[model samples]
Target: MIENRKYIVILAFLLIGMVYAAKLFMLQVVDDTYKRRADNNAVKRVMEYPYRGVIYDRNGAKLVYNEPVYDIMVTPREVHLDDTLAFCRLMHLTKEEVITKLAEAKDYSYRKPSAFLKQVSGADFARIQDQLIEFPGFEVVPRTVRGYPHKSFANALGYIGEISPSQLEKMGKDQYSAGDYIGISGLEYQYERFLRGKRGVKYIMVDRHGINKGAFKDGKYDTTAVKGENLVCTIDLNLQQYGERLMNGKIGSIVAIEPATGEILSLVSGPSYDPNILRGREFGKNFSVLQKDSLVPLFNRGIQAMYPPGSTFKLIEALIALQEGVIHPETHIACNRAIINCHGPHSFPDLRSAITNSCNPYFVNTFKRIINQEVNPNTFIDSRIGLTKWREYQLRFGLGRQLGLDIPNEKGGFIPSPEYYDRYYGEGHWKHSTIYSLGIGQGEILVTPLQMANLAATIANRGYYVTPHLIKSIGESGQPLLEYQQKNFVGVEARHFETVVEGMADVVDHGTGQYRAKIPGLQVCGKTGTVQNPHGEDHSGFIAFAPKDNPKIAVAVYVENAGQGARAAASIASLVIEKYMLGEIKRKNIEDYALKGKFVY
Candidate 1:
């Protein structure tokens, strides 16, 4: 029995030894999990960032391109530096900054690579490339920063910056890291997905001191980074630069659109900085200066700043009245100053003449009839019902709501609803008498310059408009977005726009806007508004479209504290039309006046 027990113990011991040997073989050779872990110790995974897409103007002119930059990446665990002070001097960084950055990298991950210094210019990086070898764990990686050759379209193009921790959390660690640059606003933010190309990775072989030897395994596990898709913008580069020059000293915006296509020709928000200022190492300092400026150059007034539409809104009133059969082309209303203040030189103006003359009482009465059509017996209820219907028409014109411009931070200008009035007054407590100022484009009706330009485009298209867009095409396909191709009809008949168009033409020919808005050889149609301002001088505003037969450009210009619309805004719009239509400005005197921002008739 003792001999049998000894043999059983020996057999059991042999079986255990065989199991142990098999497990070791599986871990070391068959299953690559442990082998990969060991390989990670000597291999460094470097991220290869793809270049962001280039931006071109409608005429195929390069607007924005990429400039090569370098980022110094560090692996905390692999760092072997004896003279930290020498390293700081070579990198143009303070010793304290180096210590802080190294500590931050260590806290993030001792073994992982993090950006130690970013956005070093190609010229600067060239000077330090050879010296970088002295610092063991630090290596240079190629990256790109946006380069604006034109240095225009600061607000529309936007700027890029390091992604915030909050953004990183939502984007997920697999897609973005802490130091990744991202589009912050404007078209850059709107088209980031198409602009930010796929990132590739390369497994690099490293020595004991973390100095890169070469590609691991002859670059077998490497990926090639794909470049981002290019963008073809609808902006006319010449027109944009010209508009920027015209609006140099002004504190307003000019938005011009091609009426037929709704393509934004030029969008200028004044007090804008050069797009270059927001790039490179000085970005942080320059951005802080812009933010603190009192004029608020960073605020995109073209689509974000809302202002009272002023008298330019009268065209919509006439259309809505004509649509509802509340007024006809010859319908006459006396210029009754008792009803509302009157300024234009006309009396007992008909519907067409009222628009040409901008007679306040005529529009006030016209809006009254449109709103209080006796839809309800009670005046309060009738006003609410009328406002609801009026607001619907206004909304169809792309007012009181966001136009879905392909840029971030677009504010929808207010078109007061019955509910809005209810909050201000009380439900059913207001009537056309209380809200009559809205009839003249005042009181709570506000619009962005983009909306006003779109409004002009809508009228030029005979009551329909394409949604304005900055991008004409994306990638090599050269196709605009589907939304921009479709027409958004403003619930008004095409015929109603004929009389309004004729009146606008007449206004440019012999009315308030005649002096500044009349462009020779071009049938420029326009309306002028001297918006009342309690704070200071009235805002000057004008909306126009040229060549009454086949209109090309529709523009809206608003110059704050610039008195009458016929002064600065009208002059600017007419100059823009002449420049676009004639390809030159013969009226250099008017251009000079606008450039100087002198609000004189």
Candidate 2:
């Protein structure tokens, strides 16, 4: 009995020893997960950020570039400071700031690296880099920041800043870490994927004191970062600068497009700031100042502001009326000031004469005749049907909706429909006389300066236009964007444009716009508009294209609170057209007048 008990105890002890030895062998030799975990304690993985793409104008002038910068990175688990005060002094930080940053870093991840202090200049980094050895967990990572050589095009070029928490969750942890910078607005936001290049990694061996000894495998495992692709924008830097100068001290916007190709040449929103102010460490403070200013410099008025199209829309009405056969080129309408006010007295004028004279009564009467033309047996239904038809034609001209511009925040100006009227008034309660204000482009008709400029381009092309775009070519291959190359037809016959074109030409020859809009040798077709504003004086607006035979440029100018289109908007348009075509301003007096004029109410 005693011998049997001894054998049983020996076998149990032997089984326990074999189980322990098997487990140790699996952890130390068979599995790599534990080996990687142990190596992480002695190796530091640093990310190498690539240079962002360069932005250039159509003429290859540099718009945006990169400048050297540095970020002080920290690993929370490795932090152990003997003297906190000395470390804070070296980093130019307060003790509280250091404490808060460490807590934040630890919350992100104790094992991973995060930015402690970002966007330090090269000079500032050089001053403290030698002292970084004393701080066990901190190191300097070289990076680049965006720089603007010319400081112009603040709204168009946009700015970049540190990613927010919300953006991080959307991008995910694999693509973006905690401290990455991203494009915030404008072209930067539009082409972020092309502008932001791929990141690389480098593994380095470190000692117990957290000092980098050398590359872990002589740089065999390191990967080089790829630089971002370059962009060739459609904007003409010289023309953009000139337009900005002409619009100084004004509350307005200017959009110029190449009539043939629909390429945006220059887009200007007044009260702009220097883009340089929005870069580097001072971005937040400068941005707050810009936000609080009463002028609202950040608001992009070119594609975002909605204003009544005013008389610049009359050309559309005339074209639609002619296309629907509601009126003829020789159709005569008597101008009755009692029904609708006109600038002066006039008798029955033909379509061309009425357009040149800008007879409000004629247009109102013409609109009534078209709406009341007995298409349907029921008068109410006929009016609705006619207005619906009118709305369709208006939409074809790129009105009443977004024009699909490449830039962001474009507002599709409002164009009321029969349903819109029925919602306000009962279905059968309204008539053409009830909405006669739309005849002169006044009531409930709003348009952005970009849309109006597109309208001018459409007329210059006779019946079709290409989608307006800001990019001419992309990448090293210089491939043109094919989406903007397709033509969008307005569905109007080409013959109807001739009468309107002749009328606009006569408008520059001897009409209300002649005095301010006429160029000496080039034939300019233009229309003037004075949009009524209940708060103040009417806003001035003008749409024009020069050298009518082979048109090069179509432009629209809107001056808020100005009295008449001819006084401010027309002069500005004329000067811009002259400058673009002639390459120099022969009429220095007109330029001076436009610069010094007090048209704002």
CA-lDDT, candidates in order:
0.90, 0.87
Cα lDDT tens digits for candidate 2, 1-601: 9999999999999999999988888888887777865664466788899999999998999989999999888899879889999998888899999999999999989987888988899999989988888878888898898998877777878888888999999978777776788888988888888888989999998776666778987988999988888888888888888888988999999999998888888889998999989988898999999999999999889988899988887898898888888899999988888897888445898999988988898888778776777988898998999898888988998889999887678889989999999999989989888898898899989899999999999999999888888888778777556878889999889899999999999888999798888989899998999888999888999999877988999999998987899889998999989988989988887788789868642
The number of the candidate with the highest TM-score is 1
Q: Name the lDDT of candidate 1.
A: 0.90
lDDT accuracy of residue 158 in candidate 1 = 95
Per-residue CA lDDT of model 1 for 1-601, tens digit only, reads: 9999999999999999999999999988899986865654477788889999999999999998999999989889879879988898998889889899999999989988888888888899989998888788888889899999988999999989989999999878887777788899888889998888889999998765456778989999999888889999999999999999988978899999999999999999987989999988899999999999999999999988888988999999999999999999989998999988898577899988888889999999999999999988999999988889999999999998988788888889999888888999988688999999998999988899999999999999998999999999999986987998999999999999999999999999998898888988889989988787879999999999988878999999998888988889999999989989999999878887878876765
Clashing pairs in 2: none
Per-model RMSD to reference: 3.9, 4.0
Alpha-carbon lDDT of model 2: 0.87
